[model samples]
Target: MLWRPFGINETIPTTIGALTVLVAGIVPWMDVLNIFDIIRGASLTILSTIMMSIVLESIVFFGGLL
Candidate 1:
């Protein structure tokens, strides 16, 4: 009943892709537009948190095998 562009039922990846395109389009004008500066700190914090989570998960996964 619903349209699936990516050929799968999950929509999260599609949504992220769309957002990435939108951001890419706006990146060229980031210097002229100060909006990115406003969120830079928050974005960096979120990215670091995600990176740390992945590192911890990998350590635990490998530790279990050893």
Candidate 2:
């Protein structure tokens, strides 16, 4: 019960195999790792800095300080 492209007699199994391995690898580590553990914190810190800088720049720009 495999739906394959026309003219190809053998079903393509490589794609299925690769996806299976990828999911299996990630499923085990999901609990031990999370975005807030590293990435989310860093990203939020960076975003806050950028936003503050923009606000400061706007004040300076409007005030003719720079």
* Candidate 2 vs. true structure, TM-score: 0.40
What lDDT, from 0 to 1, does candidate 1 have?
0.76
Cα displacement (angstroms), candidate 2, residue 24, comes to 10
- Candidates' C-alpha lDDT: 0.76, 0.70
- Model 1: residues with Cα > 4 Å off, grouped in runs: 1-32, 61-66
| Per-residue C-alpha lDDT of model 2 across residues 1-66, encoded as one tens digit per residue | 456667554535676765676688854555446634768778999999999989987888546633
Pairs clashing within candidate 2: none
Pick by lDDT: which candidate is best? Answer: 1
Per residue, candidate 1 scores C-alpha lDDT tens digits across 1-66 of: 377776775678778886787678854565535877888899999999999989988889546654
Superposed model 2: Cα runs more than 4 Å off: 1-33, 61-66
Q: How accurate is candidate 2 locally (lDDT)?
A: 0.70
Q: How far is candidate 2 from the true structure (C-alpha RMSD, Å)?
A: 12.1
